[model samples]
Target chain A: MTPALLDAPAEDRLAAAIGEMARRSSSAVAIVAQAGSAARCTIDYGWLSRAIVSLEAGIDAGRPVGIVARAARVETLVVIAAACGRQHVPVAFLAEDSRDLVGQLRDWVEVDDSLSLPAAAAGERGRREFETVPPQVIVATSGTSGPPKLVDHSWDSLLAAARLAEHWHGLGWLLAYDATRWAGIQVWVQALLTGGRLVVPASRDPDVVARALVEESVAILPATPTLLRRLLTSADRGLLCRSGLDRITLGGEAADAALLEEAQATFPQAKITQVYATTELGEVYRVADGRAGFPAAWLGKALPGCVRLAVRRDGELLVRLSRDTAEVGTGDLVQRRADRYEFTGRRSDVIVVGGAKVYPKRVEEIVRGVPGVAECRIYGLPSPVTGELVAGEIALADPLPENATPESVRAAVLAVCREHLEPHSVPRILDIVKQIATTPAGKTPRKPHS
Target chain B: MRPDVPNAIVTAIATVLRDTGRDTRPIESGMLLAGDLGLDSLDLAQTIVLLERSLGCDPFRSASTSRSVRTVADLIAIYDSAVAPGAS
Candidate 1:
């Protein structure tokens, strides 16, 4: 599909917004109240231009730029706008360790302490000029390998992704504003480009967020599965059902079929869709309904100019993007069934013992049925004799009403798995963890066990 | 006690922090939530959930206000003033 913004230059709207901010700083609250009763205060756009100008001043002073940033907030948006206007490469930070953040931003010349954008330059009617260049953002990504890596994307690439996303989704966004990570960058820019309101929260509370959705009449919300889970659990069934949301899109981590089913049950009116994309690759496929598996109906549709997907010779998934010609193969294994393919967990997450192949998610499905087990991660660990054996790391929902032993939990999990799985798929050893390994977004971390 | 501070606010916050794997020993009021207790954003969300169940006021009402709270004292101060006499 032809992205609406593609015909025109990418920076036109952003440039116009910067000009507007330059003219009106004091008249309105561009970034609203962060705390107290004034927590919802809205600062004018001029304040944002001023913040950019001030931050640009630091960059001019040979300072590495470090912005304590969030997304969807007026300040954060302004800062992002300002940085883009000033042609400064903004290094977006996550809600991770500050020390780690500092280390990651070591190359930055000036760091803005304000987590949100500073609203100093509000309204000055003048010609606001910007120097465009390749994207210099040190974006944090959940690389195919380890604890996310920082990748650089030119402004062109990001802007293209935004335009493409807006075109594909057709609905404007009510960004979770969780952070300026992958989800945030896509949602905010697309909304802004389309002149759609970027709904910012008063807080991260599920109840508060739920209220905001109703109050704002937010049509679309892109969120992690964990956040959606908490939102559904925070109140009665009618909470999200009556809210006039059109679509609730889930991404970042893998989707749990049970949770998707729960969402469908709760919000019968709203369409529930699952999206799978990475920072390295802008959204590849937006699966309409992956509750059963990857939706085939949505496949073969015109992808953004940036994405192309195909199964590799080794049965893994491979991607080729416009930005990069080299196909970056993913760890996920897919088995084609006619035109639609089924996700067989990650190739690395598979266990093979005694010439038998097993997937962790298959084992997890069985373990999830066991009573008192909150969550589980299954992977293969090295065993001298079997080469590798199935292992499970389980987190109990709540201590077994006070007297539950690890042995009891293990027995329950194994029994459930044995009842469902074949002899080869049953976990040989199970370790009880206090909590499942999750990324900051709360997706269960399912690295290969070995 | 300060006019804004509640009688059991400190105990409540400490209990919440303990659930997050913080040292419960002599749970002090001055302990910083992230700096000293290793609590992250997720833990803060959990703390809000706990306080709502135990106390009444939600210290994390919106994103704008919640980001400023770095320490337990900071959180307690906000929570105390929110639940001060005659305030909900």
Candidate 2:
């Protein structure tokens, strides 16, 4: 659907649409929570209706309620559907360990595992009268340095770029992102809006996720490049191929050309697309050509009346969403090639080494192309001679061969880095490790030196 | 103390520095990996991997052991303890 077609109903009418959907498909399976091949639970629309009725008492129109960030939980979805459908309360998904929630969520009531709603007031049956307020959802930005900022969006803004088709209904969508976040919420909204089945993995384990995909026969799989890379290197990669995924959408992180190429080669049967989206910007534009970045012509061009893109003098991407001429700085740094613009890294993540600016993501992308390097993280470290030095921690795809030694492997990786990177851009310090740490949002943790 | 543990650690540290195109100064027990030898976190990690390969065991397998390794002597001590009699 085009953005113009999605603007027919005001944001206030979104709750009414959800209520109508519940009335239409009461017996259809809405969610399937699974761990590996084990089905944890399945909730149909009838159960969802009962859940909404039970949760309605706690929701107030125009108020913001906090849903604790828990993946694959039936109650989490219940709070979302109830708060979004009945009262039109803006839901704020809060990470469990987040420290900023106290100040940001002053008026929000936290809904956790202990939340209890009275049993439908004894004899309540069917749909209750729902107050129609402006539909809103608050999602937190995944910033690495400072506190995560919350971005508010209406249902129209969230679903403006969704491609709603008849065949989308009843297809299974794998939920890999946190449902409260924008990426996770997009998957859930896409499935719920079309009466499709949402497949929620029980854990972040790639094997478990892969098995769940096969067991649920997930058709649509949306994930970050980091998570997808993990799945690709896992032993259960065959399971993902056998799951018969029809569509694979990579987002949340800049998808490099090497990763895009590898994914296309691995999932030959699925249509792979990379989405450039941010929590503050909503859906910007999607690249379906199996390339690293969008075409160069896309710069300074308006996309379908929904998004406009421009690069600043410093190469930071400025995006104008939904016909709004006021462009917002996305903080993403881009490099323009002859015909395309590739995202290099975030401007905030750049490290100044010996007066030369270096993007860790650029170095990481180059180093990742080296054979036997499964995952790696690049960061800046304090140096006495240079202002800061480029450093990297790499996890091997497999243990060193019986005939090979660690020095040989280290030398091989260094050789590749030297060939692709400039002398200063090459990592001065490189380590082979068992694993690289990732943030809660499934991104490489790039902690700057103090 | 294991007689070869110190030699193995020193050799690993030298190789890591040389591969990164840094000066391969002589390593000693008194030298601090970070302060004196200029080895960052990544270099230290590579040194540990090389040491494990040479010694046939990883002394820094446990967090406590890894955390205690600050100097060349400390790293050699970890390897010495790991290879000692009755050590797990």
Candidate 3:
């Protein structure tokens, strides 16, 4: 999301994969898109086959080209499939974030709903082989910790770890990640590869996403831990719990114990799978255990694609893609806790107060246990006394606790910290925020200065 | 001077002491934070931040930086002065 020359381009593997899966049934729905919670649309395999044929004819370029589009749009996939079908590699760019990249891209094509899908000729797409191959499609990293880096992938490489058994038929999957991005592409491809229907919410807003989930009965949800935590505190908390969410996929950031435990409790029936993968390392091993981090025994073990996991002395996990490729530092700090290696926090996110390192993840795990607390963010605040001081922002649970006030919750948070944590690790500055602030990528920023 | 400023300071000190399981007896303005109260430097740092949260300002962080406090009254006086109308 890789290698092939001659006829079929590297990028169209995803479309071909969809074309291949399109043979399962004539009326199989592949995509469910809800724009602005108003326009609900459904695209079947017959439509996809039509769009590919029509769009492929309009493309004349034989080299790589770029398209400025949003993944939420089905047209983005249509154009990408058409370009890939024509053997022209395509690079995707978000409309807003494409300003700085427009001049850099060799051949930029503007993709929107206005680019109509050519009408289907005569009959439905026939039962023929689409020849799914690794077509190199350019995608960018989430740029959570740093600047976004463009990476190349194909359907074969992108969906390498995708489960394609027939049992996945008609499963409703939520496109929680940007359909143009890595995690989002996985959900999109997985839904298409299997006979599942991919659900695209109007927006990432918790209320809208929750409504889409319950309405569509989305079974498979691939999301970041931050989004999961926010959804737990949403107004539709009760509905989401009872929804048909059987598979909860957590990725993007490190899944901490508190978030994992809460997500498990919220979706008790759903099987929680934490995927430890990066844009550079591609799809690595997955953890199904309801724990925070991967198993300790997985260390130095070679996973699929000949990738092995190791840790630096400073606690950063090093992922080596293959036998020959150099190790890629994940920047994720993992600590060994007995049998399992739990991700304490990011190496860059460590809060050092008075020379002692304080992991915000450890502090958040303690704060999240408080009865009234819904979510909490522990960050480092600049201090005249210490280099950095520990500060906490707490967001109370959705359903207010009985006989509980903000004053009582704050007091309980303080008492719990004093009882459990060390003096320095205890947050001196406590704020009961309505909600914990998150980055654009739906991650809690640990540095207050930022 | 506002009576609540010194009162809140004493209450904040007692809250910290009680939370830390330190003995809070014979406490007065004359009591030394380091010796009589057995408040370590780390505890003092925490006290300043807590006071900032409750009282809204850190005296040491504004107007003055080198000012040192030996007793509880000195710490109380620093905050009271900062909260004054003309105080920074």
Candidate 4:
């Protein structure tokens, strides 16, 4: 891995990196969007520069600008480059359907395919004027449980985890996450910083995404575990193996050992890595040992004076970003095993049954191990007698066997849960549901169970 | 009334369950499709499609009637009512 670009005290590394790449190879493909077998659109560094110059002329300096548009669009990226890179204006990327747009964004622009550069401003360009203070890049939280909040990051902080690969080229990245989000931004940043191509899918469909991966010859794929599971199950597994994927980075949700092992088995060529990160805190650390969590030795260890880890008495993982004493709570509950700290579940996702606390992820893991269960969601239901009763909604795998009945599957699931989990953790009410609802952010909804 | 409608629905569900490596023995009319059978949205959809193909009619197309189906008995009732005498 190349060293991180932290030695240089630059204001906007994004702009500086793009400027350098434009000078090096203007014809290099900067962005690619694939629909089916062929690329629908491909933008080079030269075209990107012209667009950025034109866009920069219109925006005012030293102001936060919100870009309200679909993340997959090329124009959205252009706006981000112009606002955050050239004009030194902070850019907040908001989804088109975002309802909470009025607050925090007094100056915002809505972009679409119809956006075009003015003929007069197309020729006016020099190097981007680096501001003394780097503009912040704002990303919204996934809002799985509640309304999304905007988080700000400087260019240095945003590219903290990105490996510096100045000489690397032709690296294709599949845009699996929402481009407006931190994970999505990281994908493009890493690609752009290294002069690689960013592959955008025509749609969020699993087949389309898989096709893009194969057609674009994508090397790095960063995605949430939920999306990865859906892709693995819905798309052709053989096709994925042939896609030449070198690395698979999973984040956003807890990466269980089962999923990690399954990913490893499916893509033997790729190095599967699980990243512990949050929207609030950037990437904390990454585990690539083909295991579920980081080694227990990593506890209290500091990484190059930039980050330090500590487990609180209550089991919440606290990360100190800098050498200073300031720390942030990850809101995740972890348990220290003999050799490693395993992520159990989110603190807020714990369901209390009677006086006993049960983590839904633990129950879900146990329930999913049952033979016939394809997918499941564990939650707490209101009960006057027990305060909250453990409940589960399960989806059976397709083409269930002739001998298998609903009761038999339920019994099997309950039996496994009883064996693996505590008595209180076993779901008291197990329902076979057609589907478990997911938030718009593609996260399983942990809303208070009605 | 189609005398074999209930049998056909049961047979369709049982075949689907059996093919998918699930137990089909507990598929009684009184059992809840979701709670008792562990039929998720996808399984339920596949089951309905199979039922429609076997019964030669789409009960779910009638929103007013299909909305009431919560259990195996309710599914059988819809099929019985749809294929019964004087039924539209």
Ranking by DockQ: 3, 2, 4, 1
Interface RMSD of every candidate? 17.6, 7.8, 2.7, 13.0
- lDDT, candidate 1, A1-450, per-residue tens: 234434544434454544453464335333333321225454454665566666556444442344434443445554654465344445555544222554566434323346333443222322236434433545665433565666666556667645444344334355564455656666666654444455666765666677667666677778877567656655334556767877788876566667788778777777887776765566676667546346444343436565667677777877776544877877777766665666677776678776688888767767866767766778775543355567678877644635667667676676677678776677655668775655554455555431
**Candidate 3 residue lDDT tens string, A181-262:** 5666667767765657889988887888988888888998888898888887664767776688898988777887777777
Ranking by TM-score: 3, 2, 4, 1
Q: Write the per-residue lDDT of candidate 4 for residues A1-450, one digit (tens) a residue.
A: 223333543335555566566777888888886644454788887776666665555553323244444344754564455444545555666654354853666545544454443233222223355545566666677776567777667766776888775444558888887776667777887887776888888876677888888888888888887788767755676677778888898888877888788888877899988887776676778778988777888777777447788889999988997876588888998998789888888998888866889989878878878877767888876543355667678878665657898778887887777678776787766668765555556566665442
TM-score, prediction 2? 0.77
lDDT of 2 by residue, A344-440 (tens): 8888778777788989998888777766778888987655345566778888877555666666667777888878776677776677777777666
Top candidate when judged by lDDT against the true structure: 3
Residues B1-88, model 1: lDDT tens digits: 3333443555555654443334665656677767677665444544554455456666455333544777667777777766677754
Better of 1 and 4 by TM-score: 4
True contacts kept of each: 0.00, 0.12, 0.24, 0.00
Error of 1 at A16 (Å): 3.5
lDDT for each candidate structure: 0.58, 0.71, 0.72, 0.70
**RMSD of each predicted structure:** 16.5, 7.7, 6.7, 8.9
Give the TM-score (vs. native) of candidate 1: 0.62
Give the lowest summed-lDDT range of ten residues in model 3 chain A: A1-10
Off by over 4 Å in 4: A1-12, A19-27, A37-39, A60-75, A109-111, A116-133, A166-168, A401-411, A429-437, A448-450, B1-88
Query: Model 2, residue A5: displacement in angstroms?
Result: 14
How does each model score on TM-score?
Answer: 0.62, 0.77, 0.78, 0.73
- Candidate 4 recovers what fraction of true contacts? 0.00
